[model samples]
Target: MWADMAADTRIRRTGLLERYHATRNFLGLDSCVAASAKYSTEDRRPLTKDILFPALRQVIKTHPPLCVGLANESSSTAAFTRLHTIDLSRIVQFRDNDSLRDALESQLAEGFDTDADLPLWRIQVLGDNTVIFAIYHIIGDGLSTIAFHASLLRALRDVPAGDASPLVQTPNTILLSPPIEDVTSVRPSLSTIFDEVYRLFAPKYLSSDRKAWSGNPVPMGVNGSLRTNVRLMSFPAHEVTAFCTMCQTHRTTVTAAFYVLTVATLSRMLAGDPRYDAISSTVAISLRGAAGIPKDAICDYVSAHRTYPPADPRFSWPAAAHHAAKLRTQKSKARENIGMLRFLLGQYVPFFRSHLGRKRASGFVLSNLGRFDASAVEGTWNIVNTVFAQCDVVVGAAFKMNVVCDPTGALNIALTWGEHSIESDFVESFLSRFQDAFRGLLV
Candidate 1:
């Protein structure tokens, strides 16, 4: 029931995710988010729109990124999906857990294109309790989706059932506009831009361990399809507690621990490769607070930390964690706000696209939302575990890892990459070794 947002008609500017996707898409890449949540018979709550759709729709109504209206044929983005109700109990029969996968598979197999629906969102209820919500990366991110789902659960409890209320409101705060201090698309005095120009024009003097598969791709063209698969590796409750305790003891955060873990794994992988002497990476940082973006807004305000570890022989595990803490602190305390500034400038110029290269992987990417507030969806409809994942990543980046620690202290990490770049078997093997490296550091 909100008034239409005021603005220019032709300027349908995309946000962080869409801009990132557009660059990647121009480079021939696409992405999506398939987040799954499980519940049981105890969750007597309703799964229909009447119970949760209003709040979800309210999020889209306010946030333009989450919408799919006619922006001319050039802007072919749909917002909602068809209301297809298929009873998995009767349609596709199966024996065990594969049944769940089968149900999800059949639904997606229905497919969609630019002419599908208004909002590119859908809900699938398997049997009874299990619910799978799929959204294109254009409309959501790992954190925003978490907030959206968490908000939906809260709305469910807040609005009584069978309440045919015409208005469904999302209580979460929203940021209607950017800050006044934003540069508004000016390059300012960024020497780093010149540094990149120097590097690009420089001779290929530094060897980048080509066999490491972390360089500018040779452009496999349309043949370069990015196939992604999510594997959930969880830490035991006790190990989870111990890991957090160790991070605290080391005066670092679990996010830093994850950074150290990924860096340590990279180091281990490149131990014998003399060409590779160092690595730099980025971790997604939320701008809801830093950039004043609202909590409920379905837009991308994530910044990056260009994490570069020191060349010390003894830096491992706990030591590496503290180093990560130091690097992170530098990123935050820096005189120049890289992400926030770029986001402000992004209003006029798309700079994130300039960053699409193998060089971006000098540190790879890492994201850690930590543990979600399970109490937000507690009691009958408690959210236990999450099958959160993303697809269509930039190739030659090695891999993209997202970390989430559920309420029970169970840490879940998902590593995704394009199969065209790295063999699936290699990822599994590397992940196996990464898990081993983590176990070695467990105190």
Candidate 2:
């Protein structure tokens, strides 16, 4: 009898572990959205505590998993066994946008200061029904934000919880087996790697080097500094797809093409000695289902791969495409050895976090979220637009160009920069250059 009881307990524990693993894998790859709104006095007339709070409460109840994080070795799964209450607060009013900006700046300055052991979320009301919600990137990605927005709309429309489709699940399988070998292969040597990383990421260029420009420069009379500008741009769905097809012909992904093009354009724009060589960009590769790994167990199996573009001014599209294909192949091999690399790094140089501030080894980031169901929920609530909030990067070296695609075939591209680094016009020019490159490829 004693033996039987012990066996049963062990079995239950194992099952729980599996579930937790699945939840973590799902949550980690997710990005976050810090959404805020401003409301006028007239609009406040219909706002009621009962109506707004209850609706929010309802949304929370239905999406309770959003408040949970990965607890253990399990990567992408959500287990209800461990849950945390996210503090949702309501502030009455702010004197002006400066006040609002200050409050947000303070929050970001803390840098994930909330409970690390538990999943956390927060909601702050600026005034009336005007609220801002800061979701940790651990729970959702840009694509997931769209899903959350859709879920909110459905909940507002009184859609039955049972009727909603389940969030897409990416399989998670532990690929880091024979862990020691995997660790050794990818581990960057402490001395050499850090030097390389530093040289690549540290900021050397000044804002004055390029013509200064701003799109919404802290609108005149605004007391505070502009935290950052969030802009939205969409490519014609069909046109982007057509361009992707061209990339497919070269056996390269659209993301690879984007990275190559970005490097080329930036090199041209910067136009100088250091800019001539290959620019290193980081690529976030999804480890879902790779090497027969189960999706439920994979959480943050993402490894950043660097791609170097040809320095020659005469580099052609086909030549660039060929190089990208080769780089992708090399990176794929490197990923297979991720386990060994991680273990070795942890053992030899545990504190070595890649410094994105180094410009020599790091150029920019290109992230492809693959496809999401964009049109999944519509006519339920008015979605003015969808955009992604940038992730935190090193101050000097953190300029980013991110691209995400939705199931409805929309491609959203965003350029995020360091607060003090580049002006908004640089971003606009980069976008224009991206479009021109895409057109060039198409032609």
lDDT, candidate 1, residue 326? 72
Worst 10 residues of 2 by lDDT: 8-17
lDDT of 1 by residue, 248-274 (tens): 877787777777666666677667667
lDDT of each: 0.51, 0.44
At residue 145, candidate 1 shows an lDDT of 63
Model 1 weakest 10-residue run by lDDT: 78-87
Runs in model 1 deviating more than 4 A are: 1-12, 15-17, 23-28, 41-115, 126-128, 160-189, 206-219, 294-296, 307-322, 326-363, 376-379, 394-396
Indicate the residue-level lDDT of 130 in model 2: 40
On residues 1-443, what C-alpha lDDT tens digit does candidate 2 reach at each position?
22422221111111221232232222221123343332223223333443344445556555543434333323222222233243333222223233444444443332332225434445455443344445654433333444455555445456332322222221121111221222234444465455455544556452221221111111122112224444455777788789778777777777667766776777667666552455545666644334343322212234456555544433255765775676566554545434333333223211122222222234566666655443434433333333344534322134566566644576766555545445667777877876776677666
